[model samples]
Target: MSDFQPAGDGSGLRVDLLAIADLIEPSSRVLDIGCGDGELLHFLSGSKDVDGRGVELSQAGVNACVSRGLSVVQGDADADLANYPEQAFDYVVLSQTLQATRNPRQVLLELVRIGRRAIVTFPNFGNWRIRWRLMAGGRMPMMGNPGEYWYETPNIHPCTIRDFVVLCRDLGLSIEHQRVLDGAGKAQTVRIGGSWANLFGGQGLFMLRRP
Candidate 1:
């Protein structure tokens, strides 16, 4: 097992979110798409002093964010991203929610159009463990809860780290920075966008900007 530990400042951010937070500058405008419970936003607001706004699809999540004094709205990324003005915020974050979107390419285009930079994180379907499991069991690999079946999972367009890198290139988005985490959420030293990273990385985090 990887000897990775989750990073937090008593605000309870996932390791991926902590990596995302590190890319953001202080006192900048941020729009977090699918900001569940505003945990990352709350962390950013407290630690980085950002003007954070969030859009969550679930009303329960929005309500929870509001309860924590966060500015969040209930909205869908597939349809609502088109309504935003061009370059409206300093950063736009879509963490682990890209696979669930109906039109990921269009959503990515809109993310760059609406914000100066975009931070995206997703589970790497090309991880060796996932591949090994599928080959050994002859079934879809379960990255999260093993009890949850494939049909019940929310991931529709789950892509590998290599797939994501190619998509960014095709979308004309420059990868400003990237981090690949091992199974235990530890940042790896492997070269970004390389085949080794794709095979070994359990999750991928990318900071993208339009060139």
Candidate 2:
């Protein structure tokens, strides 16, 4: 319904969504948190034959996914994840939604508890432009494409790549794979806590599991 193969690239996914799909394997059971319009689920079902389920916060989003024949339900991420059973899924993905949650740490715990592996992605709050904007303007920074006003934006408690790494270490979550994507939306080599990712990377994606 939403154009499954936008560019004939086989996945019909956006830059970020394509990357997230690449991290998933064939025929895996996946639960997508904040799965905006079920684009990823649609793509996965077509390309990977995955068992995909999604939870979205908006009715419109849910409707869109349903129209595409994806299994999706409307729900709040911060509260709903707690109701899912332990290790019920092979993979749980929280793509670019970490910062918007009411309690990221608790949500993170639930992610690992509900799935054997958790894939998380978020915009890097430590991008130099974000830093420069706040420092230069003495106010909360405008962000993302066609950036929104500080007070009106949905993003709350945004964190950096370094900050996320620290939190994962503190929580004892195993980071099986990690990537820092730059402004062009391409992943770059990064070492945990290294200055490059903290200073220049505009986004981060990570795969986690409990040890």
Candidate 3:
């Protein structure tokens, strides 16, 4: 049986974020890159007593996080991450934001360098829904939202789960743990490293560390 648990109902977090929280240890020092409105940081701070900090690109998002009393700064993951020293935090998280980074490889390197471990989550371009839509309609795929057009989407470096795994291997990063999520962002009971998961999983969640 899979150890993945269903995200708590009404946890005031997106299912994916909730799952990420579960992967964290209580009282840890955390840095949430591309934290958006600091939802994960806030939740971790309150529930897990984590000493949470955040970096968000959007000014509005920084404002929102600051208003919520989260220790967040306005910064870009692509460039600003280099300023952090090695092993500065217990965990560094990038959730659903990898595809949007200008240089994902550099950002990922920075993640593992700055934290003992890194937690990453992103929509899987290899999901069957995306593949079907692209093959059938011959247009760029959309993830259940008709309003989001291909050109307008922020995902510039869209990648499949397999691509991510290969990148991690190439970078010499160890996969501490990994899980697949279903359409509702709930963790699924599937072999996350298998082809079946690449075909059916809606998203990929990973815990990574350097060797």
* Model 2 bad stretches (over 4 Å): 1-10, 190-192
Instruction: Name the runs in model 3 displaced over 4 angstroms.
Output: 1-8, 144-146
Candidate 3's error at 99, in angstroms? Answer: 0.5
- Write the residue-wise lDDT of candidate 3 on 1-211 in tens digits: 0123346676667778898999999999999998988889998999999999999999999999999999999998998998899999999999888998899998889999999999999888998888998999998886534567787878889899999999999999999999998766798888988999999988899999999
Over 84-184, each residue of candidate 2 has an lDDT whose tens digit, in order, gives 99999999999878888999999999999999999998888898998998899888876543457768777877888888999999999999988887654
| Residue 110 local lDDT, model 3 | 91
Q: For residue 56, give model 1's deviation from the true position in Å.
A: 0.6
lDDT of 1 at 185: 60
Question: Relative to the unseen true structure, what is the C-alpha lDDT of residue 90 in candidate 1, on a scale of 0 to 100?
Answer: 100
| Model 1 / residue 123 / CA error / Å | 0.5
Give lDDT tens digits, candidate 1, residues 126-169: 99988999999999987655466788777778899999999999
Cα shift from native, residue 178, model 3 (Å) = 0.3
C-alpha lDDT (0 to 100) for residue 191 of candidate 3: 98
